[model samples]
Target: MQGLAQVPRLLLSYAGVQFEDYHYENPDHWFKEDKLHLGLDFPNLPYLVDGEYNITESGAIQRYIIDRWGPAELLGKDAKEKAKLESFLSIFTEIAGAAKGLFFNKEWETAKTAVIEKYRPKLEQLDKFVGENKFVLGYLTLADFVVAEDSHYIERLFPEDFKAFSFLGRIRAEFNDLPQIKKYYEQPKAFKGRFFPEYAAVTIEQ
Candidate 1:
């Protein structure tokens, strides 16, 4: 599934790096058969095996790809800027955690209003943070890919909620319009894999 893997996938595509995009149809089977032999102390789904280096954790994988294949400007012009970018990226986990409650609620219709009310303020705050910038830091960076991918569930589940934040939509368009990224999305493989189908069903509803 794309899940956390999307961040690195998008970054790698944007960087024009040739890489394997493996998806697990049955994660339990894969874990039992393959994970134990991987030699990683902390084996996890969405892991990256590049050359002799095997990396786990989505964030670490994203940074490694960016450092190795992406432009230096993707990190930032200097240390302070990079730190600030990281701070913004860190907020994504909180946003995703909050949205997950809404996505997985068994009584979604009953819970939707309250969930939206609780998260709307935070979403507005993010809108302000994004402001008029083309990307999170006014340029394409790992932060853009990470934050955008994490927030994608929310955008699909609540289009009106995101429409209120015009900058968010613009950023999405900008990211999708990237030639390499555009090509990747056109592939059928991009849409394959299980990723919260119940949530997707809810999203597709009128």
Candidate 2:
């Protein structure tokens, strides 16, 4: 149930934003109930319900949460930095999009090579960009979270390919080691699995 929805929750936790997290073991509650009741303009899986702000779309929700609750630097220090972060985000989106064939379509046997090949150049760029830096943009920002989350999937699903991207593992490890993230994982309720539902064509425990 975590899946894509888990990303914002991780950002919320890291930002020290206290919010209720509901994991629907069944989809009925969302599709039949909440989707109809929640006043979101665009109803989606990871919608956020603040007292008056109802937002959907993972990228927008991440921006809202970080802008409202996280440190100012999380978004970026200036316009140029924000632009760079968005560029990294674009790469992440493409990499994740390519993974859909392997995970949801049950195409791993035939699609694995294509997926890994698709990631090679993008990952190399990221490794070079992140060379020895503690975080993207040289400090914690939304890009780090997005990249780390995607990297977690890659590392778990394609260990060999992931190993070649040295900085990715470092970023994920450093992110997980952050005080807030470490505390979140230490909580009894924290759960980890493939970033997809159990019914997915492929699953990897992360």
Whole-model lDDT values for every prediction:
0.73, 0.80
Report how far off residue 58 is in candidate 1 (Å).
0.8
For model 2, how does the per-residue alpha-carbon lDDT over 1-206 read when each residue is reduced to its tens digit?
66666778888888887778877766898899988988889988788889997899988988988888878788889999988888888887788767755777766768778788878888889778878898978899988887778776677567887888787788878888999888988987765645776778887664
Residue 54, model 1, lDDT: 91
Q: Judge candidate 1 against the unseen true structure and give its global Cα lDDT, from 0 to 1.
A: 0.73
Per-residue accuracy of model 1 over 60-151 as CA lDDT, tens digit each: 88888889897777888789889888777666567666666666666766767776787788778777887899887888877766665655
Candidate 1, superposed: residue stretches over 4 Å from native: 186-194, 197-206
Itemize residue pairs with steric clashes in candidate 2: none
Clashes of each: 0, 0
